[model samples]
Target chain A: MPPESTSNSRQKTMVIVGILALIVIATAIALYAKNKDEVGTVTENPAQTSTTTESQASGSTVEYKDGTYSATGNYQTPGGTESITVKLTVANNVVTTSDVTTSQTSQEAAEYQAQFKANYSPFVVGKDINDITLSRISGSSLTPRGFNEAVDAIKSQAQA
Target chain B: MPSSPRLRLSQPFSLKFEAIGTSWTIEVYEAYDRLGDLQKSIQQRIAAFDHVYSRFRADSVVAQIAREAGNYRLPDDAAPMFNLYQQLYDLTDGAMTPLIGQALSDAGYDASYSLQPMPIRSVPAWQEVMTYDGATLTAKRPVLLDFGAAGKGYLIDLVAQIMVQADVRHYSIDAGGDIVTVGQTLNVGLEHPDNLNQVIGVAQITQGSICGSAGNRRRWATYHHVIDPHSLTSPKHIKALWVTAPTALVADGLATALYFAPADSLRRYFEFEYAIMHEDYSLVSSPGFPAQFFGADS
Candidate 1:
């Protein structure tokens, strides 16, 4: 009878340990789940930020209004404040023809300005306004410098 | 012996067009102004040239080679270009990889600027199996060629060569952003990549070509045209690079390699001038770089 009671007591202690082990494991799992939730909430993906910007303003796919828009891009060279007057004619959400006339400057400057006028018109002529990337051709180190700004200014006006 | 009056100094004639999936400009300072001839000739020349190298065109040599990976007898023109490529491949320690074609397609630059679906495939490291003899190109493994880095500038060099061969001096070939001058000192402003309209500095070139490669343009999903092969990472350090050399081929190749190499280390292999914009928006230039560079805002 003494031996049998001792055996029963051992079984009771084993059952209590089992219950305590289960409780410890459940608490550990809850903590892990809580930590996972915090990480997901706090960590913001870098990729998400870039996509947000592309969807809003500078995207080439934006369905801009078709109309004539004009703007001036201002820059400062060593000489003085320089400006290029841009007149854009948008048709079917694209800049069909652009006229860029620059304020007077040196001979090299005038050539670059002329080169800009020659290029600025055709680059945006046919494509969807949303698809146009002015940086596609950033112009030569010497020529076609200020043309992109004029394009951006005109693009702002073309935006519906 | 009087020079041809048409070859004398005259009002600069200009031509602009879109080609190779980018903008192109031709400026003639003091030479025969054959804008009409230039328009017809350049289009035909570009079409023929693209048939061989353009990855976008499925029928191109590069595309066909990618589709069928094996030994191929390269065309006559491809020899010189490939020779330069092999030299560059050796110099950059595989950083300038010609075998990065498959990676580009898988990344989304497949054809016509269309972005393919995700789960981008890990590109095979091609330098291990690809081989190029003097005239024959062989690949024991699959290799696709994207040549986006120096090909446009090479094309500009070829076009400029054609003009020079035609005895037309004082002509400038601005194949979109790459510019080569024959007989004039053109003062050019380096366009700041961060601010497209702003100039980083001004450079005066008497002759030769000046080419700029910027990461600010031609970006999609997670890829820029310039990819580093060893790391298989995106453009992280260099934002923009400008190189001046005797030809567009050298200038263009060096400009691309500059992205991988520090400007000081490159002095041993090649002699050229360069200015680079870092990822942090700071500017670093070679000692002999003939440009008046600007800092962040000033």
Candidate 2:
């Protein structure tokens, strides 16, 4: 009778150890899942904020009307303050011609203007005036410097 | 490792580097010095030169000349290129004409390389339409001059001169494939035409200019950018040519012209040491060329 009671006690002890191990495993898995959820949420939060910020920054789009729109901006060069005027001939939402009228630019800047006229203007002629990237010309450095400044001013005024 | 101590100077000095088109940067050891100001002044001077000589801009002197079919008067800044053009015209036996723009256009390079293929048409010979009289350039017919071959190299030479004028002793100007070096030695790796990843030869350029001409990167089919004036077609004989000279412009211009010239004639013209790669991957160099350029016996 004593032996049977000892054996039963040992079996009960083993079962309790098994239960404790299962509980520890479950707890570890739960903690790991919680940590993963926290990390995922934290990572997604910045992405969501950035998306909202981007939407806010670029939300406004400029509307173009049929007719000629012109704007001018002055830039400081090595020689003097040069004024660059951009005259855009917009018809049916497309820009026909983007002519730079003012001629206070340095000789280098003038060369920039001619290149802009020859290379860039042709590509933008049939494209939507508002949606076209005026900043793409920035790769040309000097030419883009004058043109982009003028275009940015026009873009802001048009948006307003 | 011990760090080197910074030396204190009694007077300030300015070093200026001019290369890669109109862009220039100045390094000054001291602030608010006359030398520093001079560096900026030198930069402006070079920038003005760049403006006048730039072929990318339609209002540039080169562009104006091109638009007017070499009829326009050469600007003071472009006098050097104009002179070099005349020299190259005579040197190539009229093989490398500045008026090869129509030929390049007809060979499917009418616009920028980034653009797609345009309609290819037969172009008339450049020598038949264009004429130059040392100072004045006149076009008898509608002719286009494309200085793509020698433009970058000439620009490099100009920048090297500017650096010398500015008293910058140690520097290098590398515009794409064209390179000019001064002061310190610069290691130049000659790219293999078949495999761009590998270097076929390496040369140490100390004070001279070196140019590599190959159709590996810029070409359509077997016909590459280097057009033979005699045949008006891409030559299949030579795959690559590398030349070094006192001036970058000459080296670059000769590299392109010789690639298109007949093998025998080219060998005769290139009396100097050079490395030539044949279409079948066989390589040959001038006997006078330094054997040290190649790691092993060629």
Candidate 3:
């Protein structure tokens, strides 16, 4: 074989090996990052977090601030004092979704709270925060008042 | 297979709201994470049922069936309802008929709630006009399905079935007056049609259903909504009737049937406890019914 031809073949082999090395390195980095990301997610899920436990024990769960807002509220009922926690997702200045959790000492109160959530959330879902007018929601008079308070807190936080 | 998710609700719980244009109270022992979802589902089911059975809506399936002649495919969930309806029809000797819708419209309790009976046509015997062969519902002639007697009660029963499937052991569903109680013994007052807020009797039961029929609330001009299918006029024989049975559907149908059937003839249809208020201001009750009249109370 010609000396120049031999040298060119050797260079081509070296280049192919280098390209394979780069591909392997890139794949390793991607797989490591993905695993790390999965670990982070499992460790940081809000529902399973210490913060969530603390807030739940204290009668509320607050979460999701970027484009979403959460606040804890208190209300008075014939059964005494109870707490309500609301998490709202906002898009285009309108409330998109609402998740409400009520911390009540009585099963009856909790059930009432669930009814309030089902009834009132629809009216608030697509409305702007400034226009929310709470009313007597399916005999759940107190929860609506608490919802108003929670909305007020979210408004103050978002400046919307 | 993945094990079913467990819902760890403690003690007794209740949920109250409105649907199908009436108040409803639901009490249950256990609730789940998806209780709100279940409530929404129930609301959707009721709305869908209303869309099919509502005579008020011009576009409802019943109204459409009345307008468009010939055989039509029944909705999937309609088979059981038709069976129950047929049983009531035969048991009541055609008095508790789905064929009464036209007669009711003629008497003025119409889809428009105009409260005027300008019935375009008279309703004949339901068995003669309609035929149901399990899968298909055919109208031999133009007829309307009122289903007013048992629809609401059947709906309550359907919802109860859903709750039962979700592992709910103790529950009570009170839709306006028609009630279904499970695992709770409740004392129900039988209302007098002529006397407001005055009950002629009271009944108690657990794991059973009760429903009452009266012309007290829905009356217009000189007529009440409860029309006798045969005469096309409200039956004055019994002013009000309440029945208790294994399910709300049967209880409601039996209450309507009592308006037509003689007191003794009812034993052939089903076993239930009932109370009837006669036109002469007399109240009679089954031996098992827990009844104490206002004047009879010592």
Candidate 4:
């Protein structure tokens, strides 16, 4: 073979090998970048962490007193104005009793009052108010929503 | 031959079967032994029960009794219904009266829905019509007796008994919103009163029953169905109420009764152990109520 042709063939082989190496290197880099992004996204967001901390802090404090507590919110079911007036009596760190003096609600809302009296009032009687989530009732939804708003209002008042 | 996936014969056969005028799913590990025979027997038993209980069927035993008695004498076949009526009468202080059947009919519910507007009328005091003579029941006035309250639960109890006799262990019998579970625990979602699709709470129940009572959009305008005997009108005080107990019958009966009873009286009645949701968006539970049934807060 001629010397020029032999030299050209060697150059072509080098170019082909170089291109293969570049392709492998690019694939590895892409895989590494994709995996790094996945891991980063799986980490919890800062906002969620902060909110959780706040909830935990709120859950640990107890405040009880003899006073009237008011709560306002919108009703989900028979949509209308919602408000509750609770006359609270507290002895020690527990709420001794709470009487719902006034409630402005629709007919459907009034029906749930029995359930509230039956299910929720007793739980708040003797515990440190901080340990209870006023809204957690297994069957009653509308009444608990109102009761939770009332509880939040009471808690805010206590903090103030 | 290439080995196929392991044939796990021990695994329970979970199958959905439609019977009792509705659909139900049955799960049983031992169902494999006589599956075909058991299925046939179940279907037959459900059909028989439906034939006896269906108010729509003119030939049903209930309907026949209602026809023959002519609003006065109690039919022999209706003795069980009469017993339930007596219990509800005592529980609700006559608020949950079977005599309201005619009133409900007058309000446009005659076995089917009537879209026409109905005038709100006072429900007659149950004492005006119902009287008992040791074993026989007599109605002085022409009153209707609708078994919408206790019928579903009674049917579930019967079906559960049959299933147990057949050795069908893990199963749940859900009739409309009433449910009874046996052998295995069931995670049931308590639907929101406003939106049926949304679930506000979940209850884990094993070997018990749960019933939900609420005024849906269907009965929106005049809450006349669950009437309080004292007011002779719908108890506008309660929007929705759900109760769980050892039996669906008691839960259902109490739900209807409590929805109409005075708040103080109702509270005293349920002092034993139960959960109640009032209309004002408040929830109350008895000391014996189970918190574990409700899932842990997120």
Candidate 5:
């Protein structure tokens, strides 16, 4: 009778421990699911922000009409104020051709004009060759000099 | 002895003829009774030059050299011309070479004007295949030598010398677009590579020669006369370039050199002024290059 009573107390304690362990495991699972949901929301915010930023960039972008354009700009040089005319041809919003004409009012500016180098721009217009009376033309179509000093040297060498 | 009467004409005396597959004009301010003699002499000189240098001609000295490799005698005038070519070849690191004749012909610029491109072989270096010691050009193998780069300029200088020897004080020679002016300053138009009817700018030449090289003309199938051997393709970065030097030889040679190297590099070896037009139509000129650009409004 004493042995039977002891077995009954031990069974009661085992049942209590198993029920407490199940409760603790259920609470830990619930906290883990909540944390997973929060993590998912945090990652989604950056994707939303990236999409909005890209749309804003597209809205602010400028598109240019394809055609020829010309403008004149003036800048102060050491000599005086010099005006330059720029001509450009734009295609697909990109400059395809450019030409710059410098008109220097002061003689000093004119002297240094040769050093002026034009960057790639959209200026594309120029005077027609037919409109002007050119004394001569330089190109492949017309085809066609130190030579004296070299010749003199050659002649003297031959005589020697 | 009675001298020939020098007739002061209201207009300059001019002679026009066709040679070396191009038109040539020789103009002088004063007319001479010996104009016919002068014309004959000029024709003979050009004929001799063409006979010796023309690779298109089967009987040309260059063609003979192409047939077999050996030591060949070149003309006295070849000294300065060859020297210039050697210097340019060294300077450009074989970018500009006379050995490009084979490449040019292979690209369809041949004696028969085939205008058909074939498989191109890399051009052998000048040092490897041949040796040019002033007068004698020794070739190790049969190589086609092309003087098309500055030959015309050298010839122009030679023709000018002929004129000077003839006692002509003021003269201008135009072979196609290349012009040499003496005792006068002439306004020269720089032709637009894209549009022949218009000019991009104007330059003044006085007692100097101005020569231009462009990709617009003499081009076929994306290949122009100027070819880089390393790539075996025509240079397309530059649309056109013009060089002005005391002699036409320097101007003409440097015009081709500009396609490979910068103006500052060539200026170190030769005294010349240059204007380069990039493919985008951007203009770059030397500080002393006497040129004026016409904008859209002009």
Candidate 6:
């Protein structure tokens, strides 16, 4: 994410210092892992799926091949089977961009999908929950002041 | 082999409470031991703010202003809140006004939560009804001033300030839907307005704030919370909008302002990233907005 537009030089300096500290901490962890014979852990995930002979010929484990990859995930929902298309661009072992598009077969699912597009917030998607945990949701809150009371009042009135 | 750049994770101490007619969730990193006292302090702070700001309460300063017009002394923090409102009011040509409180009440989003529409009343111009000089607010007539647009976000920032003063550097504060993150990055889901079970996308916020506003939540008799005093009707052009700014106040205020004016009109005055979902469900967003959509790729 880009820095806040209004961030001043002081904030920029702090960010730089923070980055340096993170790098130092990362180096220490890396050294510790190497000492424990765990140097291969970083490349394990990518190496499992990779079919590239270039990395094997070079005698080095490449964390990720810089390329665009796309996949379609099909899931069974109550309405029907739904498919989601996920596209990712990786650069230097880090994901540079990502996109997900949903395809629904049923009309009910289509309606819900239409509703989904009508609402928005800035949110990040990751393959794992551990990778990026959702802090909270930013959208039109479902809760309203005295909503339950109003509902109950209407129910009681109807019953009467 | 390359080491992953991800940081180690730990559980953050969480606090949940309801105030100002909304829910508040605060998560503090490495501050688990401090939360016991911090919770009380936060509650007290919100109570104090409600005493001054809440129009629902009969004893609130806002209620006093509604009852009669006079020179009222406001809390010191009112400067930023009022100043932002003044700026937005001018920028939108009175589309966004503190004076909308009366109109809102007329539409029955009043103190009682009546949700019943009454004859709509046009909001008076700021110059005719009230004037403020940061500290003292001079009201010429009984006018209801509602800070509903950004008060929650302002309160969240105030709570964040308290946490920072207590040496809690890493934290996230979420009130209703507005959120702020500091010293930690968080993935926040963008809830679908019609269906709470679904989300359109997720956004990554680090040391920044994000707020969203939509007319779907509080609708009654073809009206939602965001009522245009001029039209005496709720805006229908946009379905929902979200903004990410350096502070929650800006994000929250702009979320409401976007209902009145386009992002380009407000961009010159505030620095923020925005995504607006039109009534047609076509999404428009800033280039640098840190989010990934569920169905935007097509």
Scored against the true structure, residue A4 in model 2 reaches a CA lDDT of 50
The TM-scores of all predictions, comma-separated, are 0.63, 0.52, 0.60, 0.56, 0.70, 0.70
Per-residue lDDT value at B260 in model 2: 47
lDDT of 5 by residue, B1-298 (tens): 1222452776778899878766788888776678888888898899999999988899999999999999999989889999999999999999999999999999877776665689888999888999988889999999998998999999999999889888887789988788898876778999877667667888987689999998776665557789998999999888888999999999999999999887887787889999888754556788889888764333
| Residue-wise C-alpha lDDT for candidate 4, range B122-210, written one tens digit per residue | 56665675566545555554445666566556666766777778776666666655677766556666554543333444556667777
- Top-down DockQ ranking: 5, 6, 1, 4, 2, 3
Candidate ranking under TM-score, highest first, comes to 5, 6, 1, 3, 4, 2
What DockQ was computed for model 5?
0.17
- Cα displacement (Å) at residue B115, model 3: 0.8
Weakest ten-residue segment in model 2 chain B by summed lDDT: B1-10
lDDT of all predictions, in order shown?
Answer: 0.60, 0.50, 0.59, 0.49, 0.71, 0.71
Task: Give the TM-score (0 to 1) of chain B in model 6.
Answer: 0.95
Q: Candidate 4, which segments miss by more than 4 Å at Cα?
A: A1-160, B1-32, B35-54, B61-81, B120-142, B217-220, B229-232, B262-272, B291-298
TM-score of chain A of each: 0.35, 0.34, 0.33, 0.31, 0.32, 0.33
Report per-prediction Cα RMSD to one decimal: 21.5, 27.4, 30.1, 25.8, 25.8, 17.5
lDDT for A67 in candidate 5 is 53
- Encode model 1's per-residue lDDT on B1-298: one tens digit a residue: 1323555554567777777776677767654646578667778788888998898778988887877778888767787678777777777777787777777767655664444435455555545667788778787765678887778778888888677665667777777667787776566666655445445566777688788887665554555667777555677667677898888887888888887776667767777888777543346677788765533112
Superposition error at B60 for model 2 (Å): 2.9
For TM-score, the strongest prediction is 5
- Candidate 5 ranges with C-alpha deviation above 4 Å: A1-118, A121-125, A141-160, B1-7, B296-298
Candidate with top lDDT is 5
Per-residue alpha-carbon lDDT of candidate 2 for residues A81-119, written as tens digits (9 for 90 to 100): 544444545445334554444464467556544543342
Per-residue CA lDDT of candidate 3, range B166-232, in tens?
6676677887678887776566655445433234445665678888776655554445657776566
How high is each candidate's interface RMSD, in Å? 15.1, 22.3, 24.3, 15.6, 15.4, 14.6
When 1 and 2 are scored with TM-score, the better candidate is: 1
Q: How close is candidate 4 to the true structure, as a TM-score?
A: 0.56
Q: Per-candidate DockQ versus the true complex?
A: 0.04, 0.01, 0.01, 0.03, 0.17, 0.15
